[model samples]
Target: MVTLPIEFRTPLTEGDVGALGVLERDGIRFEIDSGRLILIAPRTLWHADACHRVANLRPYAYGRQGMRISRTTVRCPDVMVLFAEPDPDASCHDPADVAIVVEVVSPDTAVEDRVVKPRIYAGAGIPEYWIVDRHPTDPRDASVEHFKLGVSGAYQRIGQAALSELEKTG
Candidate 1:
């Protein structure tokens, strides 16, 4: 079995969060929520279209930003939008501050995105989560899966569409 680097498990402090916020890449400093840091990767045309749609929705959406939840610091997703009330008693991060969470599925990280991340989001009480799968025809495409947390502690599929469809709607 191959071992992935254990970098995601690093603990972070408020001071570290400040330092990370100033670390720039290609002229854009990343935003650190707790410990997980996010950087916006180069987007495909389809991605741009989807982003445009998401932007018009007036959800206070953010792309590539970290969200601090509980003890584990989750990496900022490809896109996250806030549509609800802000939590007053939030310590790690405000659950109510998050509305929709989207992830563009990559081959290396798809499983974690689908399996692991949803569980965390549900535990944090995030309401909506979207998983954008780039590969529709590939046999390995697990990308079509979209998961939303029910009142119970489980995820349910909401919608599944191609990248082109997502862009067109946006």
Candidate 2:
């Protein structure tokens, strides 16, 4: 098991989160409430494979691999779908430019992926968020929970389907 501990202790504003370097594990999930940096999770083979698959699906043009989708938001999701062409050299993106953010779940990141990330994405006005469900034991079958942000500023579960289904449809 590989562990990369982040040593950042400075109190940072929301926009400052973009300055943190992206790491192997999506890196850090900054605590906006308490202003603390927490290591996201260790990178696993399953997680890495799922990330590529989700990011490269149907709409390949808008996909971004390892970059922050929101300069004002804290957490960096696994993959992001930008409405506009992604700036190749840009480290952090504007929330208005991002349409969908995808997080591929693993054993270590399941809790954060389901709860914390959705909250951060919704608050940032991200139009959509997807949780690519992966189990620790059996990495073969991955399902997705598709969410769309509502007028009330919360993500509503719009659909659920297997990863294979999305690949097939796309």
Candidate 3:
């Protein structure tokens, strides 16, 4: 198994890191920032039902696929709507083709989900980013915060929804 803190002689792109077999390892993800590689450890298993629900709402939407935020950075969103089907063997997706990126917040991931990821997604030019926060008393229920990237290149709060209250469209 590839261990943590593996050093690279040269800066590698997101595809190169994926080829090293770590991103395939359950839940592990990394980001290359300013030529520096940073590996983020996987959190314990946590899946939101809302993520799956959102995935099925539109065509070409997928769950947990890594998205290429830049030449050197890749981030996996909980759910993403890729307006078109990608090549079958593609390792990651380009943000240019992405319509929306969703993050399902777990107890331990609040800060990253609510702040860090939205900033990254916005910077990458993702048009929309949503945060699904599970209801305190009901695991099956969730609150979704929808953010739209505006003309200024920053995300603006566009709307909100309760999963339990959403009418089924599909």
Best by lDDT: 3
lDDT of 2 by residue, 1-170 (tens): 43434444555445544445444336434333345555554557867777778877835323334334333235456788878776677745667777888988777778888998788779878889999976434558678899999999999999998877788888
Error of 3 at 25 (Å): 4.7
TM-score of each: 0.64, 0.75, 0.80
Candidate 2 residue runs with Cα over 4 Å from true position: 1-9, 13-34, 58-73, 135-138
lDDT, candidate 3, 69-121, per-residue tens: 77766777878898799887875788999999988887777898888888888
TM-score of model 3 (CA atoms): 0.80
Q: Please tell me which model should have the higher TM-score, number 1 or number 2.
A: 2
Which candidate order results from sorting by lDDT in descending order?
3, 2, 1
- Whole-model alpha-carbon lDDT for candidate 1: 0.59
Backbone N/Cα/C clashes per model? 1, 0, 0
Q: Candidate 1, residues 119-147: lDDT per residue as tens digits?
A: 87787788888876656575332334467
The candidate that achieves the highest TM-score relative to the unseen native structure:
3
Pull out the clashing pairs in model 1.
Answer: 53-170
All models: lDDT?
A: 0.59, 0.67, 0.75
Q: How much is the lDDT of residue 14 in candidate 1? A: 42
